[model samples]
Target chain A: MLILTCPYCGVDCDETELGAGGEAHLKRHGPGSTDEEFESYIFQRENPRGVHFERWRHAMGCGKWFHAARDTATLEVFGTYVAQAFEPPQEIKDKITAKRPGWTWRDVA
Target chain B: MSDVVTALDGATFNGTIAVEDAGLTGMITLRGDFASTSFQNAVTGVSGVNFPGKGEVNSVGDRGLAWMSPDELLMIVPYDQTNAALAEITENLGEEHHLAVNVSDARAVFRLRGNGNVIREVLAKLTPADLRVAALPTGRVRRTRLSQVPAAFWFSAEDEATLICFRSVAEYVFGLLRQSAAEGSEIGYF
Candidate 1:
C-alpha cells in the first residue's frame, strides 16, 4: 500500500486510510464559462503514467484533503502538500524535475 | 433515552489473545483550532485532561482524551455522562468555531489484551500502522483502518490496545478481530 503523509496531521497514512480525489488544481468552470470549458472541468482529466498531481484525503485519519506529486507508474511520491494550495508548490515541482528531468504538469513549472 | 447495548455485550473470546467489548461509553468528537488558547483551555476545563499533541492520549481517572487529528479529539467518559459532558464542552467553547458532537451512540469500543505477540499478531492482519513497542509505545493514539473498516485505536497498556469503530460496523470489526486472533493459533506454512 502507498504511504501518504497527511499534510494536516503529519501522519504517514496508508492508501487504505486515504480516499483518492482524482486530479488536483482543477479550475471550476460555471455559468459564464463556455461549453468546452465546462466539459473539460467536469469530465476531462490527465491520467498521466508518470509525474502526476493528485488530490487525496486522509479520510480515516485527519479527514482533511491534500495534494500529492508522484510518478504514477513507479509509485514514487515526490511530495504531499496542503489542499488549500491552488497549484503544486515550486519546491515540489523542482524535486520532481530533479528526479524525472524535463517533466511538467500543466501550468506547474 | 432507550437502554444502550455494547456491540459484544460482555462477550469474550478466549484464545491466545483476548477480545472484550469496552462496553457503552460516552464518546464526544470535539473539533476546533488546537492552536487556540481558548479552545485548549475549554477542553482541559471540561475533561480535566490536557490537550493531547498529535497521536497522544491522556487519561484522568476513567475519562480519557485522544488526539484524533490536528483539529479533532475524542473524549471517552461514562455512558451516562454523555449529555452532561456535551453541555459542559459546549458551554466552555463559548464563541470558538468548534463542534462538540455526542457520538456515544454512533461508535463501539473493544479492548484487546494478550501475551506473547498475540495483540501485535492480530493487529498486523488489520492495520498498516507499526505496532511494535519501540514505534508505537503505550498511550499512542493511531487513526487507521482495521482491515476495510476505519477505526481509532491506541495502546492503552503494554500488550493491550483499545479500538473504536463506527457502531454500524461494530459487529463486523469485532468478528474480524476474533477471526484474526483465531488465525494466530495456526502455524503458517510459509
Candidate 2:
C-alpha cells in the first residue's frame, strides 16, 4: 500500500493507481559498444536496500510519468519529481541523505 | 451523415442518488501549455469558461471547461457547437504549439444528484480519491479510477455531480454507479 505523489498532477496516489516503470536514469549503450557494455546496460540493476530512484506512471490519474525517490526496504518515499528530469533534484538527494545517513549517492546518483 | 448518438442512448438509473446520462455534450480535448498566451486566449476565447486551475472545472449552465492535465483541457460546449468551437480555437491559436480535437462522441457523461453527502458516498465506493465536499467542492474536477476504469468527475452543485468516461465503458461505469448508489448501499462515511 505504498503511496507516491505525482509531480505532474500533484495528486498523492497509491500503488494500485500507479504502475512502476522500473529503475530510472539508466545510461543506454547502443551499437558499436563492447558486448559487456551492452550486457550491463540491458541487465544490470542496483538492488540497494536504502534510497532508490524509480520511474512510475500515474496510470489511473493524469496518465503521466514521474520519478520517485524512496527507500526500497522501508518504502518511505522521499520525493517525487517530473519525469523529464535527467536526475533527481538536489532536495530529494538531501532528503535521502538526511534520512539514511552515510548513503553515498556519488556513484549511484 | 449519421445523426450523433450517446453511447448508452440517455440511460438512467435511480438509487440513493439519481444517475442518468447527461445526453450528448460537445467535448474538445485541448492539449497545450497554459503559459502560452495564444493557448490561454484561444481556449478561453471560445470556451465561455476561462482556463481552470489544476483539477478545477469552470462551468456555467451549458458550457464550461475542465483542467485535464498539466497541459490539457476538456472543453464542454453545446452538442451542436463542438466542431465550430474547435475551429474557432484552432484559428485563434494559429501556428502555436497545441492540439484541439473534437472528442464529443468518444466519451459519455452522467449526472448524479442527491442531498448532502449522498453524492460523495456514492462516488467514494469506487475510487480512492477524497470526494468530501471540502475536498471536491462544486466547480472542482477529479480524474481517477472509477473501479477499474479511468474516469473524471466534477461536482456542479453540492447535491449534484457530473462524470465522464470513455464511450466504450459507458455501460460499465453506469452499472458501477447504479450499484454503488443502490438504496441499501449507503455507507454514511462521507
Question: How high is the CA lDDT of each candidate model?
Answer: 0.84, 0.87
DockQ of each: 0.68, 0.66
User: In model 2, where do residues sit more than 4 Å from their true spots?
Assistant: none
List model 1 lDDT by residue over B1-190, tens digit each: 8666876677778676889988888889999998999989888887888778888998876788999877889988888888998998898887779999999889988889876366776787788876776667788888889888888877777777888999899889988888887844643311
Could you give the C-alpha RMSD of every candidate to the true structure, in order shown? 2.3, 1.5
How well is each residue in B1-190 modelled by candidate 2, as lDDT tens digits?
9987899898899999899999999999999988988788788889877779898999877999898889889999999988899889888888888998899999999988887598888888999887777777888888889999999998888878999999999999999998998889987887
The runs of at least 3 residues in candidate 1 whose Cα sits more than 4 Å from the true structure, single-residue gaps closed, are: B183-190
Mind listing the fnat for each candidate? Answer: 0.64, 0.48
| Candidate that would win on lDDT | 2
**Candidate 2 TM-score over all chains jointly:** 0.95
TM-score attained by model 1:
0.93
